[model samples]
Target: MSRVTVQLNGRDFTIGCEEGQEAYLRELAGSLDKRVSEISGQVGQIGDLRLLLMASLILVDDLKESDRKIAELEGQAQRLRHENHGAASLQAEARNELTAHLTRLAERMESFADTLEAAGDDSDGDGGVPAPDTSLAEAGA
Candidate 1:
C-alpha cells in the first residue's frame, strides 16, 4: 500500500506501487509527463475530459502499433529459429557425407601409392637399394 506523488505536465498526482518501486514508478511517470507535454499542443483547447480522451486515443494508437511490431518480431524470430534448425540438419548431413567421401578418397590414394611403389621396386635394377641420407640431427649438441 505504498503511494508516490508524481508531477505530470505541471500537475501533481499520486500513484500506487510496491513499497520499493517508488523511484521506478516516479521515473516512468516523469517520462510519460514529458511525452504528454510534448503533445499538449495537439490536444487543442477542448475541455479536460476531451483532451484526455484525445491523448488516450493517441497513446492507444501508439500501443496498437507497438503490439503489431511485437507480433511481427515474434514471427520473425520463430521463422529464424525454424530456418536455423533446418540449416543445422542440412549441415550435419553434408558433414557426414563429406567425411565419408574423404575417407574413401584417402583409402583409394593409399592403395594407389602402394601399387606404384611396388611397381617401382620391381623396375629397379639394383633390387630395392636403400637411398643415402646426409642430414644430421643435433638434438643433444
Candidate 2:
C-alpha cells in the first residue's frame, strides 16, 4: 500500500492506494479539486459537503453520457461490419456465377469446334465438294 497527500478545497487529505498508483490518485484528486472549485464559484462557497455532492453528481452525469455515446458508436460499428459481410458474400456469389457461366460457354464452343472437325474429316479436305474437275477443264481448253 502507498499513501498519498492531495489538496482539495484548500485542505490536505491523505489517501491510500496501490504502490504504483500514487501519481494516478494525485491526478484524480487534482481533477476533483478543480471540479469542486468550479462548483463553489458557481454556488457562492456553499458548504464543503454540498459542493462535493454537486461535483460528484456532475461527474457521474458526464460519465453516463460518455457511456451512452460509446454504446451508440459500438452499435454503429457492428451494423457496418454486418453490412460489409453481406456485401462480400454477394460479391463472392457473383464471382462464382460468372466462373460457372464462362465454363459452360467454353464447353459449348469446344463442342462446336469438334462438330466442325468431324464434318471436315468426312470430305477430302475440300468441304465435301469434290474439287471442280480441273483436269477436264484443262483438256477442254
Q: Identify the candidate with maximal lDDT.
A: 2
lDDT of 2: 0.86
lDDT of 1 by residue, 1-141 (tens): 799999865778887889899999998777776667756766645554555566678788989999999999999999999999999999999999999999999899778656655665566566564422223112211
- Write candidate 2's Cα lDDT for 42-85 as tens digits: 88888888888999999999999999999999999999999999
Best by TM-score: 2
The lDDT of each candidate is 0.74, 0.86
Candidate 2 residue-pair clash tally: 0
C-alpha RMSD (angstroms) for model 2: 9.0
Error of 1 at 67 (Å): 2.0
In angstroms, the error of model 2 at 67 is 0.9
